[model samples]
Target chain A: MADRSASITSQFTGAGLGRSSLIFWALVGGLALLGGLLGDSYVRHIFILVFIWCIVIASWDLILGYAGIFNYAQLVFFAFGAYGSAMLSIYAGLTPLLAIGAAALVGAGIGVLVAVPSLRLKGEYVALFTFAVHLALPPLIQQGRAIGMGGNTGLLGIPWLNLFGFQVSSIDKLTWYWVSLAFGAVCVYLIYFVILRGRMGLAFIAMRDAETFAQAIGVNEYKYKLLAFVVSAVFTAVAGGIYAHYTSVVTPKVLGTEFFLMAMVMLAIGGMGRFPGAIAGVFTVVIGNELLRSFDDYRLLLLGVAVVVTVIFFPEGVAGAFKPKPPEKAE
Target chain B: MSLENVTIQFGPFRALTDLSFQIERGEILGVAGPNGAGKSTLMNVCTGGLHASRGRVLFNGKDVTGFKRHSRCGLGIAQTFQIPTLLSSVTVGENLLAGQMFGSEARGSAPDIPIQDILYLTQLEDTLNLPASQADLLTRKRIMLGAALATGPEIIFMDEPLGGLNAEEIVEFLQVIRHVREELGITIVMVEHKTRALAEIADRILIINFGEFVMLDRPEVVLNDDHVVEIYLGKKHDA
Candidate 1:
């Protein structure tokens, strides 16, 4: 029986069964099974938050990590989704579902605006432009209309998201958690399989290595860069919409510098540019934040220090530490 | 193909002023000039990397003035950089794959010409899986050539293909370039400072001085021209 079990394990982990592939599928199956069995509210809440953050970080990774655009304005898109949906729902008396669509559109629109100028700039220029957006957006939203956004107070009592008569708020916490998980999984797969596997992926990689060279080779750098930014914004918007409904609150604080810092910390601690790195980063930073809650003021300081140390020493991050070594070639 | 009245201005400096030249199909045109003589600027304009302030780049009887680089690549124009602009992290095969993806008519439909064939052509068969960063300068030059070849271009533009190579490596690369033109029947436009080496390979040499065409004729004539020797070549034969 031991030998049989060993053989089974070997079959799964052996050549042609790429370790990452096996691990990914195993994690998927295990998560599904475990999510079904563990119906606890606390566990469900934690996982839901994880899934929401996973979407944001993963999408963020798509731009910053893969496309090599270090955008610090990611949370602005998230806030746009949350606030856009909230405003549309509150002011227009629109359905929550319609508001979600509005959020996505708003996110995409902002993505285009940001990407158009920012894509041409790289390194510090990209960071500076994105940072300006992050700083400027909330005030613009606040000053625009007191009725729509509620100004400083922010829109309150935003209705729960409902889809085709299936009320998301009425659903069980476990079911909602599973829904979030599924959404996150689909986002990951779409980014990894659809975008990264095709010719677009090659173009993106080319852009990352050398933008001028990519252009010399005939790639339309601006078009593809905008595409990446827009897609990333869409995913981030979806995550924000989900988070808004889950919490029943949409505030300026949602798009605050705190969330931006948290995301940077998470990405840095997890790994920059790796797909699984985003998820791992989200979990580590979020869980670490929660666990260090007792320290209060010192918790943030510790987190900052940890991020710096991780970046300096292990630039590859936690996921880097665990990445499987490539198989040795035959002599 | 021809560049008619092309003028490129970079801020206060005019890189190329009223430069006009024609390169026929199935011809190797060698561009030789001083460091700032605008040889590269001309190539950049031709490849659509730089938009000239004024002029029309006519390729196969079509005005490609506003065409993007990739569109020009699709129209059968390709260029290699002076500095090897390879994706350093990826293998040589992957670099060639990128070239094939962008420039090849295959459009990612059928199986690519095998990696082994590309490697064998550049004598990089053993280095297929090796990252470009791992390769030596000569190997990198060959890989760059291999990548340009993989594009399936009708015309290949090379910038100093023999820059860092030793005598043996230069001979090897010369043979490869000849094979590409002879066996594959591809035209070449080369921006080279190595006049002697280029003269041996190029069918015609176009000499530029101070961003203007000084002389454009047969390699033998241009190289032995008294004016070229006095100004650019610096009285080498006279000395």
Candidate 2:
């Protein structure tokens, strides 16, 4: 009890310049230095992917882990952001950066639309409904060619991200890497501070752990659930927007089954619902995905083995393993 | 607070049948019933966790039968579960803070009762930072009560607040409940199996069986009622 108390207290109060936070900032700085020093575009590119996916995973964690909502449509929101931003840039004549922000608003709207009906459902049903959305999205996007979605071939030649009059190009991978890093950092902090550390965080956790109790104590479940979806959707779409501009392409592949499965694996290994775990999960999976390029056909098999081993060793994911198991059901 | 002909039906099954009762202001109303007698159901209906299939719930003479649970909470209805349900992920302090922050009319305003007062009343002053999931049953129960009180509720519905405690723990817990009423002046409707504890703390006792009202009166009178006895043990005067 004492140990668990210490950990929770630290989680609540550790926003200051504590040791762990200092170490975290140092690591971020170290990675930035590495990006600057390494002339290898490949390594720098992997770091960029890591940064982008970190936002995705962290946003996913807010709803799935913190709110304990079984929302399977996170990737769909990402796809929406990708497509929405791309269309806004290509057809609507908006800058990539401004398009990303507008796309997030659209994502928030979609989040509200989805959460109002879906979040009222029981757990497994919510998962099924959202998963159905995930399955339905690609075909819908393909059929959306009349609206300049580019259909099967997807949207290409999307403008490069222009920052303050300077075009950030693919050739200057380092600039793209730093831009993504800064973007990811800002998004993660928004999630961490606005939801996880604010009053809503407590409300979300209460709603997750004990719905009836939370409601009876005046924590409006639907309100908080909707808030969770909107916040999650906003950042996830931003990540997707970044992904679109970073790659200069928007494709149906973003909504692929493999991408969803990879996300689940990252959440599993890094510990779903654990703060900072999602970030770790993103790094481990993205870097591991890049590292195992040589394995070819056997790569997925090895990744499966890694998941099994991680589950066996760290039942709570890598982050949870470091913390003590909560005392036997408070009976 | 009052319920008029509240009936809850789960498809073909009726959990509560035309249950009507009035809870006076500033009184501990002890509710007793056999297992599955709809005691908890009655609590649920009053607290807006469940909407009665038929009938009305009037809080302060306002028709709140259709209000959601949190809305009712904002109207000063708070509750503790039979099993001390808490946000296991957060600390005890956080749990109470959740109540004080959102449970009252305070919403974003100042809470009426300070969290420190609730901590001291619940005898959980020392373990404020402790994770609620790791606390013992006694502490959990106290935290549950504290969380309920933190809402600054006008009326609190407690389901089996003292269900699993030993004699000493029960004695200590009963004192807190008394403090809740005497010191805080909050109305309480407690569903408890322990009649003795209820008799000690409650101003009036209401008994039910098989979703039907059995008796409602002072502790001595209701406890001695033949129907209450039959529901508790067996037939009072068996053939």
Candidate 3:
């Protein structure tokens, strides 16, 4: 499989080709060929996990990297999506597909809730709000009497999604993988091509650089900041739905601090605010973890050291090294 | 062209009180005062950077009190800070691009203005791709001016454009400011402590003392005013 960095490099070069039409066609054909070959169950499972994570990491970048809003409770939204879907399927008697949509809506709702307070705050204050949400979510789900969120045991027997007459069973990892890949691609394209290329993207950058200056230029900081959070939450929620369906379970453990920290590490390793960086970061951290699984406890310690080293030395991450330098002036 | 009894008080200290002034179009308004005279504060209120506690700011025959800073920029008003506020992480070209991106009215269309033109106007063509943080003091000032110009503003409020420049750099900056007003027909409102320097460029000068308008007249008349000499020049003499 092509690494995230490699994929980004290819995408960046796609426009520079002499004939854009031919380059696009050839690229589509290549992706199709690769997709066909990756239809095996085990390969499909790994790809699906990667694809789902790509969406989450990308959304995380949208808020943290682009807007420079350090939201610590990002996993809360994911948990909302997973728990929302699980509850809807088990109690509301809705299909997994409907549950997925509900999860996204619920996630958006939580985004609104979070943004209302967080948007007014910045730096450590915003981080505090998000951290509070992260601490509050799991216990709320466990102790809430009316919601019946399975207390601590969590939801089970989530019905498989049926497309037309075909039931997408848990064993059909290839099908799930393809769906996730398509969704991930669409999310990345929307974020990178549409939003980042539009007026909103400029506003985000302006806000990131200087909030006072951004306001001076007529950007309503509160409106745009909320928009970043809401959009990011929607993507993250969708990824959560994929995770829930893929694993056939939804639990409080999914919203653990460890998972959120892992996502942050992925973003830091990949590059902050750069679209390609998120994808690269996720794949590197995830694959690196798997590769070092033999060391068990030692693997986590190594990951921590790696993160510290990366922050200290290569603050721009691996992609920064590959970025094209400006040509030198003629002497 | 009005401020109706605008007062801004920070706890016990009042920054501005019942301050009022009118500025007509195509006018070069020079605001001169000592430090803590609320010169920058007044500019901030006018440009919507800081909201006036009890007054409305009218721009082009409309109330702009509620408008955000960028909206004020859209309404044909822009400003440069007392301290240069260039994005240190980005290149000079990127900084200009950001300004063009925000300041222009034409939505959806990418900024097509050549980076070279911006650099040329600011005398920074040689340093187009250099990181703003790496630029020297004078270069950073020029880049700030260039970024403001890239916005294509109809009116620009410059806060201490010649704050810390040497004689040679000040001459260069004066020429650039003159060229901008002449070439683009943009109205300039400058805040400066160097009365002689501003007198040479400004059409009209407004002297501010304790956040109140002390004198509003031709630069020569304001400079020669006995009160102006007694308050500002006398302090310099005493020091």
Candidate 4:
């Protein structure tokens, strides 16, 4: 076996064979073109909603899939951005663009607060700690209604994104879709293309696969853990910022564990570690569920059955199912 | 890399008790003991995995007792696990690539170690693109050692490195260990149970009983010593 492997490697001159990612880039371009033509209707709205969830779930995949930090506070961090932007836009009267920056900061700040202690705890401890925070959040806001966090009712009339002097309101829904699509693209490029493709990404994957081995080889556990949380939180906040402006409302329901589970399910369907998997997952689960909503009460049950079938048939998820394997050495 | 009066405890169980040892530079300091004798514990202490409840660990004239495993790795100490822990999901080359990022310097240092060079050294050059899980025992063991070497450690700890190898495989592995120390000028510390393979290659042997030091001597002397024979070597056992 060793001899066979050696012979195979010797046959291949370029150990790191470079392949053109032109097809992938073209796919993205096509999606952009098609999305642009969806034309300001209810279909565009649904597409925009899918893109927002994809942005959030893609960022979540950074920690949950790549860095292997089973963080449960992903949705909570999204809530942080939504609320932060809502407060800034409604009370402080900041532009949506400026408010997005503040919201990302708020998400990162809360990220640090959650990460500081949980990073020290191994595995399930991190999950439980974050889950406790996730469950604790809505009640805290609901109870703090006096402090003007909007409590159980959530904040309403959060400002819409402004283009020049014109507000991109609900009536002009195309602008909202554009905003969501733009933010999702930037976040995906930053998380998947830049960080996950570079040296830091190698470190994260190494750390994820074998923590003790990674540590023995000099990968700092704390540094990578904190990085995964910070980067994931920052981008997830971008999704939240866009969602807040798009819907023109910020609600406590956004804090639901269902969002985190939804992200996980999307990741599961799309494939765990692949970038396209996140996008595919959001489309398959979110849009598919929307389409199935005509079945009313049976919609969730049918979706549950579908996900289970996906798990059984395509264990690697939808993205994993179609991913091409590297060509094997002949015979 | 050395330990002084190091003691490690797990709950009420004292895993390593007041163990003291000095490792000579550029020597194959082999550790031998029975199962549950705390040989791996001592290695863990030096490797920065388990912290000492008392005493100090010093390397390069500085106390690194408070350092974590990653920091200790930056100090040029690398260890291979007894159970062969590896990044099984990645290719052998990718595993070494990850190791190279932290091979000899601190985190964030540009990886300069050539993949082909380390693979050639570990006799794993051909298996570079193969997933680590698919490698044979010999190749997997070599991969483990290669990954550790990629970190550019001055001293290496091998826990039961010779486990599950045939006589010929054992000889080949010992030759590799010898080349690593003699050619690369790295220090070695290996832990094994009554394996003559470890005894034959080690320059000096450190024996322990019940997590306490028993004797430190040349392998020949230790093999013949009554106490070593009674406690660890057993009466008629000779490798």
Candidate 5:
């Protein structure tokens, strides 16, 4: 209610209120320390998953939560990044590291393609259009067998991330975990600090809350909306690229409804528009997911119930509950 | 700023028909009309809220008929709604800052006038730290004007800015409007129902009736016309 994005951005830059900053650094340090001490490959794999999902969910939050665009094509960018990076690494003979960077460019280009026409459409129409693209992508990719997309089976044997002179193979779980942690940190830093902390973020929140007023005051809605799409897409695609290389597979199933719903749940539970909340959400969900593995098929049903409860009870997500109340006015 | 033979048609009904007018710089023009007289429509056309069915809108001798709303705002045109559309969650200061960041110039440019000066003119200096939603109606209205002034527009089209104000608040708002014009040398086109209030500040009053022009003249000349009286008070006033 007190402008979630604005307050979060202020807390980010306000040296007088460095408490959140301290907490953020502690979280980063804790994750790094845990990765170094943890010996189990299974748990390390889960942490790597968390790191990858954090980038995806945070970028999605930028568009849906902060920009208020209701963009549903987020996973499309992710999928494109995965597929593009896989193709580049395999067929183009680029190293996985360079391919991932190229994949981000591909994602940005796709973002522009989707945003140009979609930004022109009003509210729900943009969502409808983007979702249609999301729905259509798998079938379109499946039809690209000639390009070695592998159709329903997906592209296999994708290369691992090349670090310095060594290939970061799947057997080296510790190396993979550290790389993911560092990559996720850098991506989240760009999103939270570089983009959202500046005037661009102000324009976004203003356009979100009072669009007509923003337009009347000279905020170009199209330009800012396009910016949100492109920036979010760049990070999302990078996350996708990381996920693909880490797992050594690229599949059309990554664009499935379950994954999309999971991302939405992360945003809802993390606190929509609340900075760093999505990170908390990714932790709660991915960990909660692993804990519920014994429930088997009921996992989906339980997740649904949890989301419904979250929406009904904690509409602002985990971040909202922890948000500081606005200060009382001086008499 | 000027409109040449501007007409706005929605389906079969015409909101404005063959309306032509020229507004000189640094003058406050009041627009008055009956309930369906299209005063707001005229304001919308000028602000790019509603595109003209046929005609050209010119600002500073250049045709801007094809410019978008924000582009028009970039060219020093701004407006306020009857109900103040403040960004409810953001603080009052940020609302003004949003305008300054985006209006009349690109991002990172020095504002033509400081936000503090605009706040002083609008008397919203104290509410700077308050969220816009928490402010009262009068304060919200002043924030609206302050934000528009922050844009540093050459002209501001206000659609019924005094609609919900009491007499005292109206006087205060009118004083702020006058100050905005006098100090900043900006042009103002206000669509107001209260002709008497317009008479206090308007350089010229444009009267329209049933989507047609009735008169455009000095406030004293236009307000006292028998035809204008008939349009407002009916045939008995004309007799």
Candidate 6:
């Protein structure tokens, strides 16, 4: 029943941005720009890898953290982006940029496809259905060898991202790192500013905390859940498409349960719903994996211990560890 | 709005039976009953949360027996809960804003009532930025009521609006309820255990026992009835 003006204000001019928050993003942007000078492509590759994971993790936060829905299909959507883009560029001879865009659309389509059927389910049911899709997809793709996906080996030699003939390739990791950083920052800004600050954001939290009350007051649970999933999927797919271009390959491993667990662990360790925490989790897990590489097979073992310790000590995630200060003068 | 010979059954148990009543426009109707007396089930039927096994519900001269919860809300029927149902993590302002769009588009191009007026009517003008969880019980109750009001409903169903409040808080809430009637002219179906306070504001009170109407009359008559006094109020005016 809101008038046109309230809707306009809520959508466009979100709760005013605080000075501290603005400063925080500025600092983050400065640090991302400095990542270009991180020396060897080895270091820059890890940095670029963190940005790739950041997109996925932030999207997960949108559904899991803010909406408080435990969705397991995010990884599959991420892999969809990569695979869709890979197939388009390799099979259809489409331009790399156009392929990535197509992949994002494909991701959104799948997101709605899964979310619509599962919106009636809550908690574990959502997990079961989404996980079922995630687990059932890789094998389906693997069996599609005739479709040029290369079966178990996956599609290799996917072209790099080329903008007007400038190749953003893995050999020059700095360029890849910058591209991912820009995309990741955009995802974070959109999810945090537009979705979270709008009326839909309030509906999401309302539905989460008290569903019956939410319904009685007019919040549509199915619509909000679908919105969360679709928003999460579209971005996750774009990230995956870029990831395929960066790695120059698309594989089943990207859709594996293990990869989902890794991303979940990163999100949890950093803070399940917090934006900054998702980014922090990516760096900690990615860099920790890189640094512990000398231990070879034991790296995962050590990383597991660290994650368990974090869960034990800070179950809320690194972002959750910091409590919000009580409102000044009680508003 | 009226219910015609309604009956609600769950398995073998009849939660409500052979119930019928009419609500006058802009009237405040109070429902009183002991525990498990189906006081809530009656409210549930009107708000479209539960369906009567038999009967028709008429709202604004239309038979609404088949309407779902949201559809009923869209037609200007809204409700609050027994427990406080504020969105604890969000600000009071956001919570109020969330209630603005439900069933609203059904009204075509009619603009919604302003948010500031709701805040003022509910006496929450200064609490616009406070998280709902931080508010005290009385404020929480007001916020929930205001949220329902923001939906632009012509009628509001309140279940146990006075639960857990002290004598002072109860009096304050009654004032708000009275203000709601005087200012908004919104018809209300208030289900409560607070008989003494409820009697003053309610123009008519409906008493039910075992899902059957004991009496539906003026507050003074119903409160003074022998069976009502025996079952609900006992000897004293307090419940």
In model 4 chain A, where is the ten-residue run with the lowest total lDDT?
A4-13
Scored by TM-score, the top model is 2
Docking class of 1: acceptable
Clashing pairs in 2: A65-A273
What ranges in model 1 sit over 4 Å off? A1-25, A36-40, A90-98, A120-123, A163-166, A170-172, A322-331, B104-120, B124-126, B233-239
Model 1, residue pairs in steric clash: A218-B70
Docking class of 5: acceptable
Pairs with backbone N, CA or C atoms under 3 Å apart (clashes), candidate 3 = A216-B69, A216-B70, A217-B70, A218-B69, A218-B70, A218-B71
Across B1-239, the per-residue lDDT of candidate 4 in tens digits comes to 66889988888999888988899889998998888899888988998888899999999878998889998888788899877767776778777766776654464454344555567678886678787767778888898898888887889999989888888998898999998898678899999773587678989999987899998989988877898878854666578
**Tens-digit lDDT track of model 1 for B56-96:** 99988999888888777777777788888676756666677
Residue B171, candidate 3: alpha-carbon lDDT: 88
Shift of residue B229 alpha carbon in model 6, Å:
4.2
Q: For each candidate, what is the lDDT?
A: 0.78, 0.86, 0.76, 0.81, 0.87, 0.82
Q: What lDDT score goes with residue A216 in model 5?
A: 89
TM-score rank order: 2, 5, 4, 6, 1, 3
Kindly report which residue stretches of model 4 are placed more than 4 angstroms away from their true locations once superposed: A1-22, A323-331, B104-115, B233-239
Better candidate number, 2 or 6, judged by DockQ: 2
Candidate 3: lDDT of B110?
Answer: 31
When summed lDDT is taken over every stretch of 10 residues in candidate 5 chain A, the lowest stretch is: A1-10
Error of 2 at A112 (Å): 1.3
lDDT of 5: 0.87
Interface RMSD of each: 12.9, 6.9, 10.9, 6.9, 8.4, 4.6
Candidates ranked by lDDT, best first?
5, 2, 6, 4, 1, 3
What DockQ, between 0 and 1, does each candidate earn? 0.28, 0.50, 0.33, 0.44, 0.45, 0.42
lDDT of 6 by residue, A1-331 (tens): 2232343123323546565358757966886768856777788887778878888888898888878887888988998899999999998988988998999899999999989878878788988998899889988898878878789888899988897999766787777778878887777777776677666667677778887778777766777889889989999999999899989978899987668778978987898755578778988888888999999999889988988999999887888778696766443
Query: Which candidate number would show the highest lDDT if scored against the true structure?
Result: 5
Worst-scoring 10-residue span by lDDT in model 3 chain A: A1-10
Model 2 TM-score is 0.94
Q: What is the Å distance of residue A57 in model 4 from its true position?
A: 0.8
What is the C-alpha lDDT profile of model 5 across B106-203, one tens digit per residue?
Answer: 32354576665686688876677787877878788888888887887889999998998999999989998999999889999999998899998999
